[model samples]
Target chain A: MSKKRLPNIIAVTLMFAMILLAGCAAQPSGDLEVFSWWTAGGEAEGLEAMLEVFAEQYPDIVVINATVAGGAGVDARAVLATRMQGGDPPGSFQVHAGHELIDTYVVADQMESITFLYEEEGWLDVYPPDLIEILSYDGEIWSVPVNIHRANVLWYNAGVFTEQGLTPPTTMDDFFAVAEVLEDGGIIPLSLGESWTVVHLFETVLLGSMGPDAYSGLWNGSTDWGSSQVTQALENFDRMLDYVNEDFAALSWDQATQLVIDGTAAMNIMGDWAEGYFKAQGWTPGIEFGWVASPGSSGAFDALSDSFGLPKDAPNRDAAIAWLRVCGSKEGQDAFNPIKGSIPAHTGGNRGLYDQYLQSAMDDFASDAIVPSLMHGAAASPSWQQDIIDAVALFLGGRDVSAFQAALVAAAGDAGY
Target chain B: MRINRDRLIAFLMILPSLVAIAVFVYGFIGWTARSSVSAWEGLLPDYTFTGLTNFIDLFNTPRFQIDIRNTAIFTVLFISTCLILGLVLAVLLDQRIRGEALFRNIYLFPMAISFIVTGVVWRWLLNPATSLERLSGLNLLFHQAGLDFLISKWYTHPSFGIVAIVIPATWQMSGFTMALYLAGIRSIPEELREAARVDGANELVIYRHIVMPMLKAITLSAVIILGHTSLKIFDLVMAITQEGGQGYSADVPALNMWYTTFRALRFGEGAAIAIVILLTVAVLIVPYLVYTFRSEVEA
Candidate 1:
């Protein structure tokens, strides 16, 4: 070949080589891209704990965190939807374990079936049956349960309780008596953040006071909304609301939690996640604070578990499956739940790795002293939750309890669940 | 031949911009309009046409109705406030005030910031924890005498949700309006002012009779831009309201459409709401837009 032609041939070969290298670049073997809306307060810290353990366990795998900052996890869901529709699904994304949600994904064949993983790892032998129920859709496990969060725990300042000569109330009557005492003393009995928090506290009291059988009936659409027990639950919520502070509606959860921390409010009826915030603030359980099952609701816990599922046609299917395994594994539970301030899903993991409060939670779970009840994203269909928001807003706007109950029922019916 | 060459050069120069507008603006709009009709909830096209059913549900929704009302109020207030304040500020600045350039830059700086960023900054400014309670805590001797109403809980209360939206919307947009007015004011020929001066017209009189008349085009332009923005105010309210907080007090049409489609997973209804909002905006703006452009062309 001519010298000039030889140079051209070499250049063409280099171009092809560059293209090939770009196409088959050394992508990380376990480059797992996980999505969750955990970019605030204790949630961020909790996520970091999981990442630390994950890195140690799978050194070759890269954990690409796609964290959106929002309290309700709405923004993260929007991003996931857009990405998934664009045919560029994420490796894994956070979702609550529920039949309605999982069924939708399953019907579309949009989720990766993890029944094999569950069977292969013998997860059925360890994880609670209730949790397994939450994780399954159409008789197949499609997601990994991470934490079982009790939504009915009433967090209160222990110092305030002791100062006021109060023990944790065990019944509805006791609760009202103590609430009145706090009210008379000019301390707000409830630190309720306007909308979702009000619903959370209200639902917690309903579940805790009504017990698991009734609570499950209500959630499963078997209990008629017109039933007297349901009406009684509504009345209990109204009674609790009467004890909330005047400034309650305007306050955020963080602000309301601060009120409890500062000993201004006697109690905050919130999910177990609030424990993480308290722990992050250097507060100890049973000293600086304490928790109880909702007043009059004994021996049953309403729980929801946060889990991760792979979207259909996930860009990195293998990596996502690996991450799901880790999420369900003993090490994953050990790393995640300690910082998450919730009980781990893995049965054999050390429950003692958690603080005093979480250990108590673990004890509650093991003794079948708790029932899984949905709060936040897990309790109702998305439509039902939104209607609750609307109804609560109306209720706070001075609508009566009858109106609130009617709206709630109608909204639930409208969601077609 | 010369004119043809000039036209070709001009079209070539603007080809990239024209393509961008067509692809990004018009293309997405067409896509969105199509999506509004279909049952595509999560990403894939569901291809089911529940014609006008989504719209019917959307209109029936108490939340969506409230949003429409809120958006209308916001639009009227925002456009008028921005136009009036902007014109007044421009007139004042055009008086050749001291530090005019600095003030102009300060006024226009909000325009440079994205709406999300503006929402964040304004949220901090208006947040009860950061500003309201902070100010009330100060022991200034004169503080107790007055200005306390500025920190009224009315803005944060559900009944006063519109006030919450208005404050941030005005803060982010008034400056851009001011800049547009300033440019228009500056465009008025010096000879016209000289003629008014010769007739012994005072500043206010001249502004009312002379400068203002000349600024009809600028006012129209300012109102159109501000009106469009007010109609679709989303990020500001989204950042401001917590989930379940005050419910739909500050929920505008766009946010309602978003929640209806995505959060509620009612894509059909969400699409219907979007089309309604789009049609409403178009109905109001198209005629005004035509008039404004025609005047500009004649000028």
Candidate 2:
């Protein structure tokens, strides 16, 4: 109640308020938030290993491993869109290279050009020139690709194939012949999953049936979607669907792969991530399951890469740049791809670190013709990809081949192909 | 002067909430309407006026047509099933059975859990390959026990896939409808039923003529509630079938809006889908709202 006591009390209260305000106003200076959808199995372990290298390099930076769990970044992309549109982007986030990054983020002016970082870190020379082209738009690099996943891969149970006296098929005719044998021997010839996996299989079949040149041409306005080649691809796809498991609609990709692992299904045409799933199930690469570039897609690499980019208004700019540097470095790529069951995007990756399947993939990457994957966000924009998925879903449900082709042509026009 | 002062005080008290609703609810709806008529098709909002192009495109798309068909099938099946089951259960409970509270709570418990949970549980049960049949070898058990016909592909059947979705949706909502019917049944006067009995009316005749007619208001309320829920269904379909059945057999407008907006980044088409859903729900709700308000004023 004394005047001196009141002044002392007021001074103490004001000091506490200022301290609290300072705490609230402080920016995340030493924090780096990396947003991704790698929250399960070997993918999560690969990310954790890469983050460990980043941590060893920058001990002061507290890495916020913000993960949105969903298969194939479906949930993460929606969450990222909301956050970016709301102007509260994370420090950095994972994006697929090529049109997914360019059409969605870079074209919208939501991403910062990382060309200078590429030059400074010598990534321009390390990453392949074609990959650099895919990651660039309007003469500027947008994202740093860490790992390359081959989408066109036919994974089979090696034991089943050896016992059935069959080899991995080399052509559509070979596939049907082997499939008939497997079917006669009481095996599901091919294992397939839900709608998206069906789309993935169709894209590989397209690549195999029409060859790489025509497959790439489908996206670049050079090839007609109504061409006979596409019609033949559709016919082959329809025939191929006949050999798939009857319960394809109810299973996820991993569950479908389980049929192959358990020796019930002869083959599954899936991405290289299936290798990661196989390994996580304690199976060796060439011993338990085997992979070849999907049937006729031999001599071509149907590729998609997972990359990270800095948003325009990202918090912790320096830390995000450091994270991108780590994502692009040889150490990071080597550390990531070995466990991710993918190959390093940069050619500088140590090949000894990879397993037998990825080693073969690396060899093919060097010798084979490279093409973008339509199902994996490399060859087309998101809207175009969704349209293809819809068309494929309808086709799987017994639509005519002509109707399926017409739908693709219409969707291609909408995508400005 | 006193009345004017009191009116001013009341307006001041509710001014914040009025502003909040005006901005957050009506303002957002207006924004969505405008966006629906724009050409913002990609990731970013362009907002150039394109008239009814988005709406026309949505109508022309076969997937959207399928969505409309699926919604009609789901709404009719869901609402009628809920009503009949709810009324039957309410009538049975009205017989003054033992463990009445326990039965009531048991029926009402599913209503307390979310639709997402119900969808998940039903998804497991309905999936032939991964459900109880596969997990516990019940399919084998059935085969051994001469019940092989019982092992049928439930949700995975392409033609009747939406029917499979309807089961879970009805399971979650019929309980709430039963509560409504139960309260209506209890509120009915015993004197009316006694009078009807004195007129040589059987239990079925009394229910068909007297109790059912008396519960008209409750039935209307249930219909309105169930109608809008069916119209705006998203989480249940998403959880149950993830990305719809084999050929988008279970696709609805709300799921279409979500994928179009968030996944495909076609904001203009997404807004058009949203407007369509809103209009459908409004068609069911506005008359009921108007009737309730008019009745309140008259009362």
Worst 10 residues of 2 chain A by lDDT: A22-31
Clashing pairs in 2: none
DockQ of all predictions against the true structure, Cα-based: 0.22, 0.36
- Give me the candidate number with maximum lDDT: 2
User: What are the chain A TM-scores for all the models, listed individually?
Assistant: 0.88, 0.90
CAPRI class assigned to model 2: acceptable
Q: What share of the true interface contacts does candidate 2 keep?
A: 0.53
TM-score of chain B alone in model 1: 0.83
Report, for every candidate in turn, its global Cα lDDT versus the true structure. Answer: 0.74, 0.88
Q: What are the RMSD figures for all models against the true structure? A: 11.0, 11.1
Top-scoring candidate (TM-score):
2
lDDT of 1 by residue, B72-189 (tens): 7778877887777777778779988899999999988877887778666655555443232234232222246665545544334555566666877787778888898889888889
Residue A309 in model 1: shift from native, Å? Answer: 2.9
TM-score of every model versus the real structure: 0.86, 0.92
lDDT of 2 at A237: 93
Residue pairs of candidate 1 with colliding backbone atoms: A110-A312, A208-A297, A301-A370, A301-A371, A302-A373, A303-A372, A303-A373
Tens digit of per-residue lDDT, candidate 2, span A1-417: 888899899999999998899668633349889999999777899999999999888777899999998757988999998888888999999989988988898889999999999898988877777678778789999999989999999999999999999999988899999999999998889999988889999999999999988998898899999999999999999999889887688789999999898887989999998888888789988888888888788998999999999999889898899899999999999888888789998888898999888888888887788888887888898999888988887776556899899999999999987
